[model samples]
Structure formats: C-alpha cells, structure tokens
Target: MKLLGIDLGSREVKVVVMENQEVSQQFKVSTMSFYRDYCNFTGKIVVDLKKLGVEDADIKISTGYGKNNTDLEEFETINELKAHVYGVFYQTELKNFVLLDVGGQDVKVVRVEKGLITDLELNEKCAASCGRYLENMAEVLEVPLTELAEYSQDPVELNSTCAVFSESELIGQIAEGAKLERLCAGVNYSMYKRLDPLLTKFKGKRLVISGGVAQNKAIRDYLKQDYEEVISLAEPQFNGAIGCCYYGQLTGEAENRE
Candidate 1:
C-alpha cells in the first residue's frame, strides 16, 4: 500500500512517500518557497501534493506546525509529538527510549515505553535551546554549522541564557582571543545546558534524536552522558512525516501503491 506524509514545518516542509511499509522517497522544501508558489490559499492554504512528487496515495497524513492550516480534507492530522514517537518506533524495534527533536524554533522530548507515550516535554518559549540559536552562534563564530558541531567535550562555559545575549557573549569571547573551536564548543554546550530541564524529566537508558539538529555530533555525543546510547534515523529530518505514514498503515486506511 502507499502512504504519503507531509510535515509542514516552520522553516521547511518535509514529505515522505512510503510503499510496502518502507520509505520509497523523501524530500524537503523551504516553507516560503512552498507557500509562495505551490500553496493555494482559497479558504485554507492547500498544499499541492503533485508538486511534491506525490500522487494517488491510498492514505495521506499531515503533521508539524502548519498541519492545522492545511486544506487536506482526506489527509489525517496527527500531533507533532505523537508523530515523532511513532516515527521513531517504526524505524526501530526499541520499545523504550527518550526522543529528542531539536528543530528551528523548538525542542521536544518524548518518553515512550512498551509502545506507548508516557511523558513528554517541550521548550517553545525560548530560542536559546533550539537550532536557530546554534545557527546564530555559528554565524557569529564565522564557521560552518558542521564545523561548529565538532567540539563539545570541553566547553568555554557560555553563561548567558538569552539567545541575543549569548551571541553578544560569543562575540566578546572572540575579541578576547578565545579559540574558535572553543567558542563553537561553548555554543553547543550552552544549548545542551538549556535543554537540561527537559532532559531531566524523561529518564531513560536510550535516547533517540530527530529533526534538524540530530546531525549535530557534539550535541549527540553530549546527550550520551545521560543515556547509555543515543540513536538517530537515516532520515532524521523526515522521521515525523514517515511516522505519519506508519500511522496511516496501522489504521488500515492504506491501499496498494499504484
């Protein structure tokens, strides 16, 4: 059967096509480009699935920040955290794990045990703990995002909790001749510290991460300290959409892929 999942995120839109219980194709597009060119805002903005290389799906699902605003009458809508948990479970056999999704504007932590969601935490009130903070820090350090994620073991202790002040602090560190790597590491570590409260709530032996920041090596390595291991999907950014597809199949609403 074929299932199509679309995640209408803040910065980007992620789409996944699943056939025979496997991800057949996946892609992402900038949210602005999608809305300006593809979305048809008659009553609600209708996403053009065909433009996303999807057509004639047996079942379709939508999720993320913009899910509620979509004009997909036939597509089912799922909560972001629920979709994230389902996606993680579908990609692995693990029944117990702490899921952390660090996106552009928010961070989400979900605790799942024995195929059920037990507890979850979200940090939407601050950008300091999210991917955007890292991006700004990287810009301030004059290094690529990949390079900035390289140093986390030993950090310079960025004390400011506000995203704007943190950037100013990083610039001050630069003027004071702190090593570039150290400054970058400080940014990474600071984000980890901001996430401490959420991580403390969901205690588990395993941690699974997804979303934009899942590719960060420094953050992933630091996260290992709290859990025995930290895991991520092959397509971490598309996990939520993929989970939506998995949910469609489980509900017996999907038919053969044609």
Candidate 2:
C-alpha cells in the first residue's frame, strides 16, 4: 500500500510518499509557493495531491503549522509534537534521546524516552533561535546559508537578545572589521545561546537534531559539547513527513487486518 505524509510548516511544506514501509518519493516546496499557487483557500487551504503526482494513496496524514488550516479531504491530522517523536522513532532505532527541531518559525526541544515523548519545550513566539534568524543573518553577511556552516571557526561574543537588534549589532561588527569567520561563528553561537535555556531543561545523553538547522555543522558541533551522542538523520528536514507516512501505514495495516 502507498501512504502519503505531509508536513505543512510555516516556511516550507514537505511531502513524503512511502510504499510498503519504505520511502518511495519526497518533495519540498516553499510555503509561499504552496499558498500562492497550489492552495485553494475558500474555507481551508486544500492541496491537490493529484497535481503532485500522488493519487489513490491508501492513507494520507498531515502535521505541522498549517495542518489545521488545510482542507485535504479524508485525511488524519496529527499534532506536531507527536509527529516529531514518531519521526525520530521511525528513522532511528534509538528510543531514548532528545529531539531538537529548529524550523523557520519555531524551535522544539523534546525528550524521548522509551520511544515516546517525555517532556518538551517549544519557542514559537521568538525567531532568534530558529532557521529564519540564520537565514536573515546569512543575508546580512552576504554569505550563502550553506557556506555559513563552515565559516565559523571561532565564535565571537554577541550581546544582542533580539533578532532584529542582533542584525544591527552584526552590522557594527562588520564596520569594526571583524573577521567573517568569527562573525559567522558569533551568529551561530548567538542562536545557541537562545536555545540553551530550553535545551537545558530536557538534557539527555543522546541528542537527535532535526529540521532545517540540523544541516548546520557548527550548531551540531556546539550541541556535541553538551550531549554524549549527537546524531543527525540523513533526511532531518523530512523526518516529520516520513513519520506521518509510517504512522499511516501502521494504522492502515491494522485496519486492513481487522
């Protein structure tokens, strides 16, 4: 049976198709493109699965920021927290760990024990610790996002607490002739500082970093200093979508057996 999982995030929409417990296809689209071009928003934003080359999927599951706003018919909607935990469990065999998901708009720090979420900390109101902050900072520095990960060798001290204020501070650093590498490190460290408080609460031995920020090598390195084992999934950003497919298959299989 084929199952489809969709994670409608604030900045991006991730889709994953699974066939018999294995990932068959995956795609990602910017949230703007999705809403502007594909979404039909009379009552709720409905995505045309057929247009995406997905038809007759045995089960469809949705999660993330825009899940409730979607009008996808005959679909199951799951909470973001549940979907994240399931994603980690489905992808990795390790049951006890901490899951850190830094998306465009929010940062989620979750503790998973015995294949379930034990505790969680969510920072949805602030952009300082999220992927959008990094994107903005990279733009100000005139550097590509991918290159920013490698530019930071030694992190400088950045005192700003707000994302907007931090931009001004970074500008001043640029004016003062600070090395680009140090500036990049400082930006990464600044984000880490914002995340530290929430992460401290659910400090576990094993850490699983997911979402867009999971691709940042500097952040992963910083996290490894605190965590005994810091692991990154092959497809960190799509873990939630993958989890949705896994869940769909599990429930669909059970129903079929019944």
User: Which candidate leads the pack in lDDT?
Assistant: 2
Sequence-dependent TM-score of model 1: 0.94
Those runs of model 1 whose alpha carbons end farther than 4 Å from true positions after fitting are 66-71, 253-258
The lDDT for every candidate, in the order shown, is 0.84, 0.86
Task: Show model 2 residue runs off by greater than 4 Å.
Answer: none
Which candidate gets the maximum TM-score versus the true structure?
Answer: 2
Candidate 1 has an lDDT of 0.84
Model 1 lDDT tens row, 129-217: 98899888888777899999889856787899899998888888888988887887899899888988889977558888898788899
Clashing pairs in 2: none
